[model samples]
Target: MSLSIVDNGRELFVVKLIERGEKIDEHVQREIMNHRSLKHPNIVRFNELRNLERGVDILVATPGRLVDMIERARVSLRMIKYLALDEADRMLDMGFEPQIRRFVEQMEMPPPGARQTMLFSATFPTEIQRLASDFMSNYIFLAVGRVGSSTDLIVQKVEFVQDMDKRNYLMDLLHTQCDNGAHGKCALTLVFVETKRGADALERWLSMNGFPATAIHGDKVQMVS
Candidate 1:
């Protein structure tokens, strides 16, 4: 109890419907057991917190939370041989540049020349890249597929359903996915909306429409106490 949540950054903060968090953790552990490699990518998003402490090859975290762990836990980054920003543009959009710069410039981590650094994004506007300048040296920029392309890892479908048809449309998609056996028991679906209010309303609508949904956004933040 001595450590705040950030100080106890020993586990990944996996977002899940409260009912499903434990199940996802169990599934992750089972998959990890099947791999002989102590350091594999699937666990990168989950066990990365533990692995980083033990000097694993790669680590992953959202910028804000990672900043808390580093600053509060007083974790030194002198041994950080690589620094990779998976969604560089998104981080900037989320207003994490100051925190990121602290990690890159002020922390005990090695400078860009001494470390392998990579910034990945679906789009890298020049202005956003400028925000990342303090952390890179002679870096090579790689762009694959179409500009502003959605991730290859998942299929993104866009629809223009009328306001009244939105619920039915979403239900149809869910039913179609279920019928196709697409989302396994642990498959997570994220619904995005323009505002926190919309997120809350949509979450309730989905629940009423027969889907288990949880709403999480800045506006809905609860005091953890």
Candidate 2:
């Protein structure tokens, strides 16, 4: 969908809204890497409001920051050709509905039919449906797969191990998987830790045990190539 918008070769402007947090930084960094790799002239990388005046083909932002920019006259929604709300339900759940409504309804942006609006959510309740009715015109509802259900390719497993035994347990699991060839060469395994120190410790342990691992957290500087 984003490719189609970029390929059109028009003076495109897109606004992507998502929840904000430390975790969001990793996701944004990954996206920035992908965007840089594309090397498309039409795609402009925007991070701050000061850069918005130079021109942006796509703007990925949080509702609060976007609203602040709009109020500061740094961003004008009048030319926005595409507005996408990713994790729409999550944003609403996080009490961002007022900000969303302010930009979509009270701003200078084009009305529903005049501009393309895409709302993506894992689950849509009554409030979400009401938001759709209020913000969209003749929108088509398409369900790609069952909600709240994992795909067959994903195998869920649970193992109860004490904190003291976690490291050894993980080492054993990885060794077993390696022996079974479950994870081929260069396959990645992601493990989540509660804190930055824990992540660093785990990464060091994995590396010491002949496994290459990198830890990313808020404290670490992320470089996108």
Candidate 3:
């Protein structure tokens, strides 16, 4: 998943995984669907959901679609005061820079004090920096510290054991947790495994052991990455 945010002097965006098995097409569809119902004077409306080449499923969009909506036409740049580019780094990394450049070039220019532009990304490389510079005026370069080192939001708990013992150990741990009421109510626990075969084997073992667990990973499908 990718998210974009804007602020007084900076913007932030991030692209990270949700479920490894989720398809790019599905993710794009979900974002477009959610953005379609919004009605706000300050919101930059989503225009369209378009698929890339058949083999590459990421959704690329255009502002023209919003222009096509009679009632929503006011949501276009003629009404908005800012342009926010999300995942600016990944867009350049994945070769969408040219398309984005075209989009920016064609957008309606704002009056002298009318609009602001923001670009955001988790990791901005040299190329992305150059692209952002091209699209933005005087900007501040501010970066928070490295992701995990500063805040440690991701906690890594490790158990050293042989691979063969992992399944049994997992089942026992889960059973104990279940007995303690962790799995009795309506809650979710996610399990991740390295390989498709390993995921399948572990899922079966988990189900057989009476734990309702699901394993989703890269090997599940070509789009899983």
RMSD of each: 11.7, 6.4, 11.1
* Best of the two (1, 3) by lDDT: 1
> By TM-score, how accurate is candidate 2?
0.61
**Residue-level lDDT tens digits of model 1 in 1-225:** 011212112223212122233344444555545444434433344334665455433344555555666787634567666565655676677677777777677867687787666666668788556855766875666667766556679865587889888778878878776676745442466777888898888899888977899899754545567
Per-residue error (Å), model 1, residue 5: 30
Tens digits of per-residue lDDT, candidate 2, 1-225, equal 334434322232223343233344334444544554435433323354455676665566677877887888877788777777777888888888998899899988789888777888888788888888898998888887886567899988898999999999988878777776755544467999998999999999999989999999867886779
lDDT of model 3 at residue 139? 70
Candidate order, TM-score descending: 2, 1, 3
TM-score of each: 0.48, 0.61, 0.41
Off by over 4 Å in 1: 1-57, 146-162, 165-225
Worst 10 residues of 1 by lDDT: 1-10
lDDT, candidates in the order shown = 0.59, 0.71, 0.49
Clashing pairs in 2: none
| Order of the predicted models by lDDT, top scorer first | 2, 1, 3
Query: What is the Cα-based lDDT of residue 2 in candidate 3?
Result: 58
Model 1 C-alpha RMSD vs. true structure (Å) is 11.7
lDDT of 1: 0.59
